[model samples]
Target: MPKGQEGRGIIDACLQALGEVGAVGGWDSSSPDGVRLDGARLGVSVTGPVDPATGRLFTPPNTDSNLAGLDLGADLARSTGLDVRVDRDTNVAALGEHAFGAARGVANFVYMTVSTGVGGAVMLDGRLLRGVDGVAGEIGHISVDRVGPSCGCGRRGCLEAIASGPAIARRAGDLAEEGGPLHEILASGRALTGKDVDECAAAGDIAARLVLESAARAVASACVDMANAFNPELIVIGGGVAIAHPQWISRACECVAREALVPANRAGIVVPAQLGDDVSLVGAAFL
Candidate 1:
C-alpha cells in the first residue's frame, strides 16, 4: 500500500490525478458515475478477491485495510462519472497478458504473480474462470505443508507462506541467527525484503540461497499442480519477486518439465510475463 493511503483516500488521489490529466473536468464526489466520459468507461483491477457478479471486494488477508463488502465499482462510478468495472488484479493481468503481452493468442494459460503474495488467474479456452464465489484463482492459499509457517490467510503452510515476497524475507529473518551475511544485515537492524534476499543469493550467501531455493521449490511444486490440473498452454509468471529474480520462473519451468503428468508436462510451458509493472494497469483497460 502507498504511504498513509487507504480506502477513499486512495480513490480521491486517483480522481485527482484524472482531473489533472483532464480525463474528467473535476469530481464532485457527491454525484457519481452513470454519466458518460466521451463514451469511455473505467476499469479498475484491485488486489484480493472480488465478487464476480457485483464487483464487491472481500477482505484481502494481505491488505492492511479491511475492504470486505465494499462496493468499489459503485463508488468509483459515482465519483468518476464513468461506467466502472472491477476485477481482481491478477485476473486483469492475465487478461492483459492474453490481449497484449506474453500470452498473446494463447487460449489456455495461467497468470501467476509471485510478489507480495502468490496469486493466479486462469484463462480456459480464452475465458476467465470465475468459480461460484468468484474466488477461483487463489493458488496462494493452497497448502503445500500440512504443518508449516502460518500464512496471512490464517492457514498453515500455504504456498504464500512458503514462497511469497514477505515469506522470503521472513524465512531469511528466521535463519539470521546463524551468523552469515544475512545475519550481519539483520544485525544492522535493516528489515529484510525479498529483493534483499535475491541480492544476497546473487552474492553467494549460503543462507540467502537456502531461503530463495526453498521458495523456488515451493513455487515449482505449485506450478506442477497447475500444469496437471489446468494443462495450460503456458503459465505466465510475473510480479515483483519473479521479475526481480528470474530464477523463480526458471525453477518453475524446470519442475514442471520434470514432474508434471505425461502430456501435461509437454503441453505446459512456464514463461516470464512480458508486460512488467504496467501489466495489470494495461489489463484494467480491457476490463
Candidate 2:
C-alpha cells in the first residue's frame, strides 16, 4: 500500500480468498525446504509505468506513488514464502492466453488491452518480446496521426490518446456540450465512461454508437499496423471497451485481413480473448 508494501494487500486478499474454499498455510521464505507449497505455487502480475529490470515502477499514473520503485516480486517472495515471478501485467496476460485462453497453442501472437489506457504484449516464436528495458508493448504510444491529441507520454497522436476508455468519455463530454444524446448519458457529477458509451450504443443511441465506432476504427487501424509489421500468428484483443463491444473485435479482424500482408499465413487471426478476467490471474500462475 505504501513504500515497501508493494502488492502486499493483493497477496493477502488472494490468500484470504483461497482460504474460503480450502486449506491454507504460511511457510517461511528463508526455509523453502521445510514444507510443501500446499500443492500450488504463486506468482504476481503487476502493471505500471515501470522499470521491468528492477521491478520498480515509475511514479504510477493516477495511483499511489509510494510503491513506485519497489521490487514487488522480491517483496512477495519474502512475505509469502513462495517462489515468485513478476513481469508486466500485459506480458503475463499474454502468457495466460497462450497457455490456456484464446491464443492457446498458438506459437506467435500479440495481445492488446484497450481500457483506461492501452497496453500490449508480444509473443513471437513461442517467447514473450520484452524490449531492452522490458518496456516493449507501448502500442498505445504508436503515433497514428502526427497532429492528433496529446498523450500523457508527452507525445501527440498516440493511439491511446485517441482510442482509450477515457478518450471515449472525453469525446462524449464534448458531444454533450453540443446538446445531443450524450447529454442524457452524463449529468452533473456523473462521469461518462467507455462502458457507458457501449451500453448506450447498444440501446440504439446514435451519438453513443458514433463514439464507439470511432474508437473501434482507431483500434482497428493500430491492430492492422501490428498485423502487417509484427506479423504474428494472431492478435488478441481484450480489456473493457473491446469486451463491451464484441463487434469491434470483428471489425478489427476484418480490417487487418483487408489491409495486411496475407493474414492467413502471417497475421493468422484477430479475435477476442477467451480468458476474460482470469487472463491476468492465469498469466500470473504461469509466471
Candidate 3:
C-alpha cells in the first residue's frame, strides 16, 4: 500500500492474492516500485554508469544503477507468474496526474510530494520525462543546505531532511522536549505531533510557530531553487504536511517567486494536488 522499494514484492503478493479472487477488473494503483498485471511482462529504461558512446552501463559488467528496478521487476514478475512494469515513481506519478489529476489539461507541470521524504514528477508538453534511465525526478536527494542535517542518503541538508513530514515531526518533538514554551503548551497531555505543532502554529503559539516557520522556510528555499532550475508553470505540492498548512504553501510560493531566477516565469503557478492519499495507488495502477 505504501510506496517504497519494497513495494515490488508487495505488489507481486497482491497480484497473487487477486488471482484467488477471480477476474480483477481494471484497477488503479500507484507505488514507487512500479506495477504489474496478471499477464504482461515488465521493462525498464535506465542510464547506466557506462558512457553512452560505449553503450555499456559500466566499464566491466555493464551494469546501470538506474535500471536496477527494471531487473528486479522482471525477476519478480517471473517468480510471481505475472507481468511487471518498472519505472521511476516520479514519472509514474506525473503520468497519473496528467491522466486523471490536477494537471489534466495542462501541458507542463511538476508534481511534488513532501512526506517522509520529498519526491517529484514532471510533465512537459503533456508527456512525462522518463529521462535516459527513467529515474528523472529524484528531487528528494537534492542538496539544499550544505551545513544542515544529514540525510538517509548520507548527504547533508537535502530538501527531504529539511521539509519532509518526518523531518518536521522530529524537529517538533525535539523542540517540545526542550522544556520551553512547547512543553508548557503540551502539558495538557495532548501529544505534540507534527499535526499538533501545525495546529498550534495556526492558533498563534509562538514556539510552535517557530518550528513550523523554520520548516516552511526550508521548504520555501528548496521550492525556489526548484523553480529556478526548472521554471515550471505549475507545481502541485502534495503530502500530509503541505496539506495541513495552506499558509506554508503560500509562503513557499512567495519565497520562490521572489528569489527564483527569471521570476516572471513563476507567475500563474498554482499549488494543488488532486489526489490525496490515493496518489500513489493511482499512479501505480497507471503503471
lDDT agreement with native, every candidate: 0.82, 0.73, 0.62
- Give the number of colliding residue pairs in candidate 3: 11
Q: Ten residues in a row with the worst lDDT in model 1? A: 27-36
Candidate number with greatest lDDT: 1
Alpha-carbon lDDT of model 3: 0.62
lDDT of 1 at 281: 81
After superposition of all CA atoms, the RMSD between model 3 and the true structure is 7.2
Question: Which digits, one per residue and each the tens of the lDDT, describe model 1 over residues 36-121?
Answer: 34446887888888885677888888775556777777776666667788899899999999989999999999889988888999
Q: Assess candidate 3 and give its TM-score to the true structure.
A: 0.72
* Tens digits of lDDT, candidate 3, 57-116: 231111223333234454556554455555554555566677788777878777877765
Q: List the residue pairs that clash in candidate 1.
A: 32-78, 33-77, 33-78
For TM-score, candidate 1 versus 3, the one ahead is 1
> Cα deviation in Å at residue 100, candidate 1?
1.0
* Number of backbone clashes in candidate 2: 0
Model 2: pairs clashing at backbone N, Cα or C within 3 Å = none
Candidate 2 lDDT, 1-287, residue by residue in tens: 12234455655554444444334344422333233343355656776555655555566543466656666655555544556566777888899999999999998889998877788899889988887777788788898867877777778878887788898887767765444456765664678877777676777677777766777888889998998778888899888767877887888888898888768443337889888877888887777
Q: Local error of candidate 3 at 267, Å?
A: 3.4
